[model samples]
Target: MTTIKNSPRNLAVTVLERINRQGAYSNLELNQVLKRHQLTVADKHLLTTLVYGTLQHQLSLEYWLQQFTRRKLDPWVKQLLLITLYQYHYLERVPAFAATNEAIEIAKWRGNAGIRKFVTGVLHAALKSGWPDFAAVSDPIQRISLTSSLPAWLVKQLAAEYDLATVAAIGQAINEPARLSIRVNRAKASLAQAQAQLAAEGVQTQPSHVAADGLIVQSGDLLGSQAFAQGIVTVQDESAMLAVESLAQVCDLSQATLVLDACSAPGGKTGQVAAALTKPASQVVALDIHDHKVKLIQKNMARLGLATRVSARQGDARQLAFLADGSLDAAVVDAPCSGLGLLRRKPEIRYQKTFRDSQRLHEIQLAILAAVAPKIKKGGIITYSTCTILKEENDQTVAAFLAAHPNFALEKTQTARALKADRAAKTLTILPSDYGSDGFFIATLKRVE
Candidate 1:
């Protein structure tokens, strides 16, 4: 596997095409391809930027390509050109000649001389003629959607939920790179100690509004360093950190207080909760259905130094077998849904997610809530959360769950977040806005029965 550092444009173009053709997640595919190719630090940064920028603004890039090429180009060729144009238009450091010349080289490999001419002509026109007047369009959704390259259905949903202006803001926000936030292992090192360690290595850090322990990384991939190896920090988003905080500060854990982390995979939340538990519990059943996911949770527990405190096991949220009536002191049902909310971080999601995915997920979410709500201990907290912004998955799903299960009650503790959050409801949503954050829906419920 080539590291991102020495990733060539031709290589990146091939990787990008593979992602589209194979229906692979862009981030996963990007890394897999980067590993085989050696790269310089500058090339690594450029490759990373080019890949993400192209994905982030794919729709917009394709918009111009369509104008330049009347013939329907192959998907691979189209993606290659878009990747080239991404650097040409958005990145000032990449010279225009370098971008176009590289595209022509890639085109020659992809097709005949005729295809090379097409690639040359399209990007060549882009450099000379410039972008279109997206603003002059009459339909606001069309304008913003084209400018941003978000799916039309998504734009309509956002526009209906938020005002046109706010939807436009979200579209713009999705184009920016989401900030990297790391959760410090206070158990392993204090925030000060961790920051100092990073500073020694030339990495920069800043506090975040998402969680008290959240740090916005200004430099270096902490994951690739000894700090992570030593269990000092873990990369997670700010919106995600809120899921653990919604537990309302568990001061006691030895009372055999059972906790269920539904949908706990890649184990970020499971580890976060264990870190905040503050006391060793008799059992914290960390569950995910996939066997590989169960292992990932275990790995995460090892990273955060919490493997001994939590049970990482495979169990579906919708069909938890051991969760009996009133059995859990707390249950975090991090339901699966159409992840429209994380579009900024995973730009390919915009293309993959569909309108009906939400409706289907809503059915699954409602089922999971119904089965799990009755299992919460009397007056114990049950937090339902998703890394998505759709109302169907957020308030609407919870409202439906409440209607189905009268035993559950809404707890308005969202307003009680650390000073940085200060959101309205204990049940609420978070949008990308200008913070370059992922959108999330979190609702804390109480088992009143």
Candidate 2:
């Protein structure tokens, strides 16, 4: 086993290299790197800023870089230049000379004289040229794409659905850091109790405006706190929690109820559902397609002390042969989409996802909904949700579902109250810019028989 020396620049470079060359996910790789190395608070901040900022702005950075050098550079060299340019353009506190010197030093340590010279030349050239004027791009979609560091395809798609100004605002909103929100585990502690516990440990938090059991952590190391370790609180975005809460609002789970989380893995919402159920003798069965994910759900449930309430199962959500029709009291389908809503947290998704991916996911989402719709009892609730603002996946999918199955109707009143959702032909869409949360769409439907 080998370990890289623990320096902010080295750690950032290593993470960036893997992401750029090996197609690694930014958040997962960053967590693994942070756990393996001991870094000071300042270094941790610097490493995170560099990795996310560089990836988020890579497209714009590359567009700028092409102005200076048309030569094809090695991936590592490109990563070095990207981070250097990111600091030059974004981090006003870091002087251009210091950023250039750090890049040169990193190059010398990691590469030969030729590479060092190449890096130095690129940095000097970029500094001399200054930033590109995005206004110079004539096309609105292309200009927004370059300025916001979003893909042109995504920009065009969003622009077609919304006005160009709204698309640009959405793009700009996702580039900023996401706010931290956590769900207080009511089974273990009250929201007020959890807030006091977190405050005693130097972590300040406020109640979430949307979720009844949610608290927004203003500042603190939440993961390292006792509240999190002991399951007094669980890290969850307000939008994700609201999806599960929306189901609870319309469903009658006050008796001995059986609920199903159709695609529950790494079960954040499963825990929320389990805790929100008012029935004393209720059961929440969480199912995932893969065995490892089932285990992950089970492990998360155990940590939150929800294992006894929520059972984990491994099966294809598209085929639930074991459960009979109209057996479940309620169901939640947090279907997989392109993850466009999570760009703030997962900055690399903009480059990785495509419009085609959303098309493919729509089929899968409809299949899961078809399979689970029959499982809910008459008059029971089925909440379809996705972490994307795209209409194709949200309203369009639900519209297709309703057209096929007239037995279920949208529970518009409940969804509006729970999500503060705008009614869009029978569904709700929560945009990140509008809600100040993840871009989530949730539609609650009731089996009318």
Candidate 3:
């Protein structure tokens, strides 16, 4: 009685195939497909797990597929086997025979007899032979790459930055699911009040170690709860909150009148800055190149009750000719990068991004910093942040910007004690393995003319 059109497994196969072939974003694509199908909550969870799990372990699955068959596979067929293999190894509750039969049925429904036979042979062979041993991978990098399901190039990149042990730890941490964390709107409610409110709505949360205003969701539907609905809290990673928290500490926000959240969209950090600016006249301009994104920032600001203190506009961060020189007190540059830090939440990034991509982003990040540097008044601060943990995007970008602009000096980031930010280094890099949060790099720069 299983149908290809609506079955969770079948839908997962379709979604994964699209992601692989067309380079579709996993989260957005999965959400769109889920809306098209009328699935129960359990089925929806299954489909989501299948899509992410398959993508998370894609490299290992493809490597195992090579052992069973050397021939090239049609994209869908390969994706079907990959998800099936993922279920076999990771989903302990799903009976192996049940997963195999379902995969075979899907293959039969989608392909001809030859393809169906090929899929059946591969799945059966995999279940019988079991997964290959990581110990057999003689090279340490290869061993970690295969075992962790990270790309070999990425593994090498991390290994080069840190030791093999650290790379292994990061690889292991990224595969684990990211916990849902939200930043409480301090202007509207305190941490205890937010927790009590969320608890009243059946959502339990614990205080985050990374940021004072951040909370980690322990259970229940936070996004659907009244606390989130009323804008008392908004979904943001704990590491992300660290950027604004550090900015507030390193810079004197009280005496400041104007602040710029360059590259702001959906305005999480913009709202955070708005919350910090207590003065009625103090304003934060949130800028993004896309009009829709600017609208999104405005929408978020209204929801968070920060609209009065924020100005959402459409503009390029690289060109800030609108602002006069030395007119701003402080600025926050949350520059865009390869997003390697979000691999846990969006596993597709590992495959989609390249080394060249990070290098190119470094130039763009440096440009944004340079464009905003001359605009800040003497003794003002510019807090630069990126979601990526790459040196090229973080440390190197700062170094390049500092080299060109001698007036700006890197200032040590002051954050929560739990963060244990290195006092000697002026920048803070939070790896995914550090606290099971998204990887982020934050650096504060002081402009002393």
Give me the candidate number with maximum lDDT. Answer: 3
Q: What's the count of clashing pairs in each model shown? A: 15, 0, 0
The predicted structure with the larger TM-score, 1 or 2, is: 2
Cα deviation of 395, candidate 1, in Å: 0.7
lDDT of 1 by residue, 1-449 (tens): 53222347766777677767777887888888668766777776777787788888888888887777768768778877888878777888778897787778777876889889888878778888887788888988888888888888888998887788888888888887778888887668888998988877777899886677778999876777778788898888987887777665532333436788888888887776676565544567888889998988888888788888789887777786677878888878889988877888788888888879999999999998887877878878887899888888888999898898887788764523443345555576778883567887788788777
Worst 10 residues of 2 by lDDT: 413-422
| Tens-digit lDDT track of model 3 for 302-324 | 88988999988999999999999
TM-score of each: 0.93, 0.95, 0.98
lDDT of each: 0.79, 0.86, 0.90
User: Candidate 2, residues 1-78: lDDT per residue as tens digits?
Assistant: 223357777678889989877889998999999998888788888999999999888899999999878898877788
Total backbone clashes of candidate 3, pairs 3 or more residues apart or in separate chains = 0
- Global lDDT of model 3: 0.90
